[model samples]
Target: MHFHNNGNLFPLYLDIRYSFNAQSLVPFFAGAGGIMLDFSELDDTRIFINPSAGIRYVAANRTAMTFSTGLMVITGGPNARKSFINFKLGMELKRKSL
Candidate 1:
């Protein structure tokens, strides 16, 4: 799960992983869509959708390096619709498989 914020906009997402055993690599696709709750005003709430794809490389031990990119879209609220692209580089850890 991940959370991102920009001013009054808050975006949340979940990531699922899949592995290709033959190559010892993982390829993943995820959706970033969730309900936005704005305490300041109910009318300001919006729904968001973001989609992304990426690949992971296991370097050593239980650690891996990841690179991914995605697009973010939001709808609802008075002229509040917006869109953008996001790129990220990160690392993750997993139990070493026997």
Candidate 2:
């Protein structure tokens, strides 16, 4: 967390991955994809790669949760050479079965 609020960046990603034992209670995943970085400041606009690995869990109700940790190598744009080690948590709501 930073005290400065001037830095605003939005990294839009597909969050795609290959899952192992997809139907199991605990599934492992790993993949990397191109990401688009959106920043108001000047400089480069190039696709960045964030390789990640994590586990996902699905409940009986079809709701799911995820935990991930990865190094996001974002070296473009202002304050150039930008990279971060991040931990992420995500959720997927239950949807109607097809």
Candidate 3:
């Protein structure tokens, strides 16, 4: 889950993910959805949906490198409904499975 804002708009989202079993370069898929709101008024809210795909590489110390890309669809807002492509890169710590 994540929240982002740039003074004018606020975006809140949650991602459902699944990782594939692999020795290295694990691939995953996610479906995400949430709301985007104009900061000035509560009435200006848009529902957003996203489906994403990514790959992950785990390091020796449990740190993982991740790269992902997706498309986001925003509906029902004051502005015209729109869609955009998005990309992200980040690192995460993974817990060992019991």
For TM-score, the strongest prediction is: 3
TM-score for each candidate, following the candidate numbering: 0.70, 0.68, 0.78
Residue 23 C-alpha lDDT in model 3: 62
Off by over 4 Å in 2: 1-7, 10-12, 35-46
lDDT of 2: 0.64
Better of 2 and 3 by lDDT: 3
> Of models 1 and 2, which has the larger lDDT?
1
* Each model's total of backbone clashes: 0, 0, 0
C-alpha local distance difference test of each model: 0.70, 0.64, 0.80
For 1-98, candidate 2 gives per-residue lDDT tens digits of 12123554555556677777866456565555464444554344445667777888886577888898888676555446567788889898977889
What tens digits encode model 1's per-residue C-alpha lDDT throughout 11-58? 454545555453547787766678676665667677888788877878
16 Cα displacement, candidate 3 (Å) = 0.8
